[model samples]
Target chain A: MIPIILFLAPALAMALFIFRSKKLNAVVICLYSFTHLACSVTLLVHPASYGRYFQVEPLNLFFLVVLSVVLAGISVYNADFTLKSAVPARKSTYYSAAVLVFSAAISGVVLGANLGMMWVCLETTTITGAYLIYYKTGKEPLEAAWKYMFICSIGIAFAFVGLIFLSLAFTGSQPSLFFTDINAHAPVFNKFWLKMSFVFMAIGFGTKAGLAPVHTWLPDAYSEAPSPVSALLSAALLNSELLIIIRILKIMKIADLGGFASAFLITMGVLSVFVAAVYIIRVGNYKRMLAYSSIENMGLITISAAIGGPAAFAAVLHIAAHAFSKASLFMTSGNILKRYYTREINGVTGLLKADPKAGWSWIAGFILLCGIPPSPIFLSEFIMIRTMFGRGMWWLAVPVMLLVTIVIYGMASTMFKMSFGNPQKGISQERFNILNYAGQFVFIAVLCLLGIYMPKAISDLITAAASLM
Target chain B: MTEVLIAIFGITMLYVSSTSRVEAYIRVLAVQGVILFLMVLLDHAHLEVLNLVFLGAETLLFKAIIIPVFLMFTVRKNNIQREAEPFMPSFYSVLITTAIFAFGFLIAFWASSNASNVRPLYFGVSIATIITGLFIIISRKKIITHVMGYIMIENGIFMLAMSVVGEMPMIVNLGVLLDLFAAIYLLGLFVTKINSTFDELHIDSLTNLRD
Candidate 1:
């Protein structure tokens, strides 16, 4: 019953938007967000119920909570952001509808018990997200949307090929693609087909997760998308894609193929950090810089999962923390864009004087992103490094630490320049609605609170989620 | 009979690789759809009536009729050039695609010798088609060509799925068909938007949003 409502809330919102009532857009969105958050929380407390195609497990519950929280934040920010922006009423309604569908699709991805259903849901997110990215259609946004749709569709098609290969891995009986059924039969599965499936799934879903080599569309889409939508893309969407990878990794572990899966993850992780470092140093657009930062964090999460044990625990924590902090950073960046009207880093300066609320938020968000002390990322990275030492992976730790340091330096230096300087001409001085800061403050407060002390119940939830991984 | 259809499907990929006209690509896609439809009909003997009807609609109506007509409409409405304008020459593209086909046959041969469950011809031709589709995307400069490449990949996947048709549930098959239709429709919409915004459909014009 709860699951049906969870899915229906957004579907109902999308249906309402078809009527094109501009005034009710915000109300419908807010109502859906609250309902989603409440449903996620209820499921978290009592997760026994099941749907035919979807289920609420520990790992999915954690992800659902993170998605709902970030989505709720985005909704709050969207309420004010929409009224102030120049989007026409019809487009705004369309944007709201797309966002609702996007959320519903991702919710489906996380909750789906069947791999094929997950693939379908993930593909739906791509289509809906492209719509959201093209919300304010122009040359740049349209290009970003095109690349996002085309590249991701091709990648996901490869994943479907991988699913076929996965089906091929089974013998003596027809294979079922339900998660539990696959896990039960994984030991007898053909290793060759399994490896092939993993590679295809990695590249396919990796494109969606913004991992390296296939991560080109990410920065473009992130930079061109409206700020609230960017927040969702960076904060929520990438994690949903990673959840699929983690699910596959579990099957690999059960098949005694954990080493093979870990090796691929470690390689992609290191490569992503290296890629992020290279782009971060020479980045021209601040929004693009944040996109690269997201790549770096996702890479770290992959590394943490690859390292296993306590590191997996840290990885789940980092996902939650990064969701809040990154969403905050993106929301604040939207505020900066609203003031400066340019994504170019050098185009605007003296953010401190221009808008102190956005500036401080930007600085705090960057610090949190860089894994500074009191940011949950700091603890996650620290645990991952310790796991490396305990596992005698000194060779891996050295490069990982070095690349992380380079990324930190690159982002901090760039952020410092943007946050503290003389106010440039042509910057808008309009009074921002206090609601604009409301979401960022909530995200920041959550990050700081988690870093300082995690409640016992939440810690238990994180531990249970990690154990499943 | 199934092998003959699969062989014909494989041959159409070569035609796709060697063609410069967008219309030729669409025609080949329609042919591939028809071949796939025949293959499905030949292979499945005891499928329920509903599943057969669904598969028929997906392959015949959506893949063969709806998609090609949609692409033709898009090409006409956008006034895109008739030529695909690939980065590589057609002869070289054909050469590479043939090489991929041979390589796929080699893999199929090796797999069949070692495993009884593997369907060598289906695996070989489908993989060859997929690789050729990716090659088309990489070697082409036009956005419309890329869409065609994507469609070719989808067709390849459909062939692969058909190789083990009885194993996958009806829901999964329907989901895959629905996703393919949605992806192609959305891609067509984007191509039209790109044509209007950039006033050109070339992939090179899309470099404005880069880092």
Candidate 2:
């Protein structure tokens, strides 16, 4: 009961409070984050206590931890992030509500046992996140928000259509759409409809997951959205969508649709890598570049999931690591935007010279994002490569390696270019931005520490979650 | 009997292709919407009363009345009325639509033998309508006309859903309604925004972000 309330309270409070006082959204988001983190910890310690509507399964428990930690970091940064905009009153009133709703919707998506319920939660994420995307109502943001809404709405609609088809596939003594029920009887379902449904589901949820071909909306959306929301979009929101795919992948295995589905996923996943590789090179906007990098990481995870076996474990671990590292990177980028007043790669230089705190965080973030050593992304990528080779798909591993290398050079060159050259004239020095700088450091430190030493508990949780999938 | 109405609905696309006036397109939407309402009523009369009521109210309120009325209001508000110029000549457009419509029927007919349980008439017409909507969206320059194109595609999807399943979870139905309504509202709002921001709502002007 408490866990259910923990999930519901944020959205409810956000709705009730935002109607009256918008500035309270940040405080409400913080309260929800703290309470959620506390509740998830409690639920983790006593698995029997979380009730039926909600449970902290080892898989979702790991996601819950990632979500809470990232939310806390975003909440702290938003405390100051929201103030920088001119409409302080509106910012305060609306920011927390948006965050709370987004947080609740994402948590619900991860924990949902029923597919219909998951779809509703995913839709809610879109409707609420649209407001955040359009925070300033600038032309570019509006364009991005429009694309996000229409594309996602269409994609989700296709997902629903797939669900209906999946229901049709369950032609047996008793048909059910519940995940548990489907898993129980997946062996006997019609192969054709199941294959068709998986295709639709993969593309539908994959669009939301920021997988390639259907990923045209990500760079526009993530780059234009306010920084904290981008963090949530890349970190928590993408994970929830991946959770749905993971669920479907499990079903495919049980149904013996494994080979076909894995081929499809690998094909799309590699296409995403290639697309991200091409686009990340010429992107002059730093924020857009980061958004494209997210596309690349998501593709890597998809391919890893296709490889399965121990690599599935690596995929889940990569999710956790990427969530932290990307959130930290985007937040630090926000700090840079504050000092430099530009997101253009060429506009601001000498970040170590101008603001060392943000500059070094930026560089370190690039290192982790590029899968360099000591970062958990590096560890996860290495394991995935090993999985590919062991599976005798040496050619597949080459593209994955090549794409990663290209993206690394792409991001490193951009960051190095932006962070080292002489400070361009007319850049303002921001003194009151100390807390934002502090928030970035704390987030980066968490990622770096986790990379250096994975605690026994977290590793246990990852292994357990991988087995369940 | 249902097949006849479905055919009329498909033929309306041909009529739509031959027209230069935006008013005629709206009229096509009005006719299409009513036809969809009737088709739903005929097909689902054997369903549970609660389901029938829900379906009836959805078609009557949203499809037939609300959406068309809303589009009409937006049309009136954006007054340079008739869309006289089209990218392709009307004769060629009609010929192309006819070919597409025939192709849609062929595919649906081919598929029906495989999926013998569902209504092929519904499948064929809906696919043709969806194609026509795409055709109009591509050929028309006016934003209002494009909105019309979107509605036609949405109507096709609705008809297809009804014909195949004949029943949907009420929650999904509600969601579908909410999404469509919100889409129109947002698109309408953007149309207004575009009109004021730039001198007109030409989509070509939104190309400022290109490489």
Candidate 3:
């Protein structure tokens, strides 16, 4: 089955990482990404061959495509990122292994028909990411890694406990925990236990997804990780966690508990946006600021998912747009970090003058991130707001619109401060690798095109995916 | 027979909490593994024979023997005898752990009204043990003791699962057990690294990043 490749490509890549040269690892990752991308496209066009445990539903197919594309982009960028590494030998193996492991894990989460299997993959991703987060091996990275493990491990443990509670809700026949079986029989589950399970799962997985109130680990982990890892964490890893929550959301829909589940999600979603917006304005680290921005976007998706109906459409679109834009932004941030040799907001200036490619990418990324015109994120945000207003939930739209505005202002201010000002004297002129520039260019180009238009096949996939939800 | 094994499981945590010696904590984990293996054999009469054998061997080999061997290696490698610098005083930790155990017992008793569905005693003692394990994790300062606390929590979870879902598939059980062991091994290795890096096992030193 194609799903086997989806899982194995990464595992094999990890093994190869241990033995192969750095150049070989890069080629392998690129090959895996291409293979993964090709399989996802084929799966989207013809769904018959897809296995039950690893079917490519339209929504997941969209995510698969985004994941593969971003990974491929990161792979190319990684070729250069590795060169800039002050400590290459010790760090490269871990980085490659993480990519391969994270890819397999993400694909597994996206495609898994069994909840228990998906949980395993999600937990596996968390463990694999530990190396990536601790790559720097500095005081900050170590601290970040510890918090990342402890918090995520506990959160995932809670998710397992939720799985047990969900299993407890079954009454007749052998109690099944597979997603397909659970969905089919969800309507008959004991309401009390089902709701309790949902609460626990939402909080548990939400922590991994970087949803607010439980998102304390995100800023530290994302800020401290190497840029490419930050990109993966923000763009790909979080989506898999979201996929887990979406699986439960599907169950809620099947059980006709949408009303209850939606209420809970809306509360968390709005809180995430408000908290992120407040934090974004004054973040000291540029990477942490972007991390906060990611939290806000994820919050938007959550709120949109809670709205259901057409809003699910918006949620899917926003997820895609956010993936591309945020990946581009984080990758470009890596460029800035390499050039400036510092992540502090005050340490670097005149980004445009120093390196136009990285600087413009930063600006363009911010524009896309803030939902500026012609960007897919803007289109998605528009649709989400319209969906809310059309449903006569004008009150719900208020905080979303207000928080987004504040976020826009905050991001704009940060970009302005970092981009246009005079370059600090005595700043060393660093050589930007051609491979890095090409990767960023490819990423930004893809993002721009996706914003302006989506290919019909992908759009159809998105529509079908939304209908399933 | 399972009841006796499960009771020993609960008592092990009390011993783990009251002790300052990290080596004793590792020993208690080995004893708990033996207790769990016996408990599984005595209680899971509904499980397939092959699964029971597999579970029995796994608990005996990995849980009882292999993991404890690794922890002992880590113990010897680090040369850490006692985690004498607990975050809280021993007396306070003991009192807090006792209170948590009592609260867990109350929860189990209150929730286990369906007598035929699950055993009240199994639920009560397992919950108490889990809470006490968590108490150890919180009150201990050393990473080694933290790992022991994690193992204790895992054991308590395994007992709870055995009590409630006696007929879990072999694959699920194996995966759960393997994952927990891997987590403990990784955490233990990290503790050693932390010890070597900083020359102290105190978790407080890992607090450099903040808003």
Q: Every model's DockQ, to 2 decimals?
A: 0.64, 0.29, 0.34
CA lDDT of B176 in candidate 1? 53
lDDT of 3 by residue, A334-446 (tens): 88887788899889899999888888988988887788866888888888899899999999898789999999998898899999978887666877767776666776677
Per-residue lDDT tens digits of candidate 3, residues B69-168? 8888877777776654677767777777778778877766665553235576777777787668767777777776666676776677677677655435
lDDT of 2 at A14: 48
What TM-score, computed on C-alpha atoms, does each candidate reach?
Answer: 0.97, 0.92, 0.92
Specify the highest-lDDT model's number: 1
Model 1 DockQ class: medium
Local accuracy of candidate 1 as per-residue lDDT tens digits, B132-208: 99999999988888888888888888888887776765533744575576557666677777776786889789888
Model 2 over residues A128-225: C-alpha lDDT tens digits?
78778878676777767766776676677667657755765665535455687889889988776688689889998998999989998889888889
Report how far residue A152 has shifted in candidate 1, in Å: 0.8
Predicted structure 3, TM vs. truth? 0.92
Q: Give i-RMS (Å) per prediction.
A: 1.9, 3.1, 2.8
Model 2 regions more than 4 Å off: A1-23, A48-56, A173-175, B13-21, B84-116, B127-146, B164-175
The TM-score leader among the candidates is 1
Off by over 4 Å in 1: B169-172
Candidate 1 chain B, poorest ten consecutive residues by summed lDDT: B169-178
> Any residue pairs clashing in model 2, and if so which?
A22-A92, A22-A93, A23-A92, A23-A93, A25-A96
